[model samples]
Target: MACLSKSSTFSKTFGLRNLLNLTHLLKIIHRMFYK
Candidate 1:
């Protein structure tokens, strides 16, 4: 049970970081278009 919970939390954090990266990429794309 403990191991399962740990893996779940790890995945959650990983997904959050992925989402942040995606947003950061989108922002860069928008800037490129505007320029």
Candidate 2:
């Protein structure tokens, strides 16, 4: 049970990190196109 909870927390953080990275990538793309 403890392992399952730990994995869930890790997945949540990993998902959040991926979302941040995607936002950063989109900003870069927008800048490149606008510039």
* CA lDDT, every model vs. true structure: 1.00, 1.00
Candidate 2 residue-wise lDDT at 24: 100
Kindly report which residue pairs in candidate 1 clash with one another. none
Rate residue 23 of model 1 by lDDT. 100
Error of 1 at 16 (Å): 0.4
- Candidate 1 per-residue C-alpha lDDT over 1-35 given as tens digits, one digit per residue, 9 for 90 to 100: 99999999999999999999999999999999999
lDDT by residue for model 2 (1-35), tens: 99999999999999999999999999999999999
Task: Look at candidate 2 and tell me the lDDT of residue 34.
Answer: 100
Highest TM-score: give the candidate number: 2
- The runs of at least 3 residues in candidate 2 whose Cα sits more than 4 Å from the true structure, single-residue gaps closed, are none
Candidate 1 lowest-lDDT run of ten = 26-35
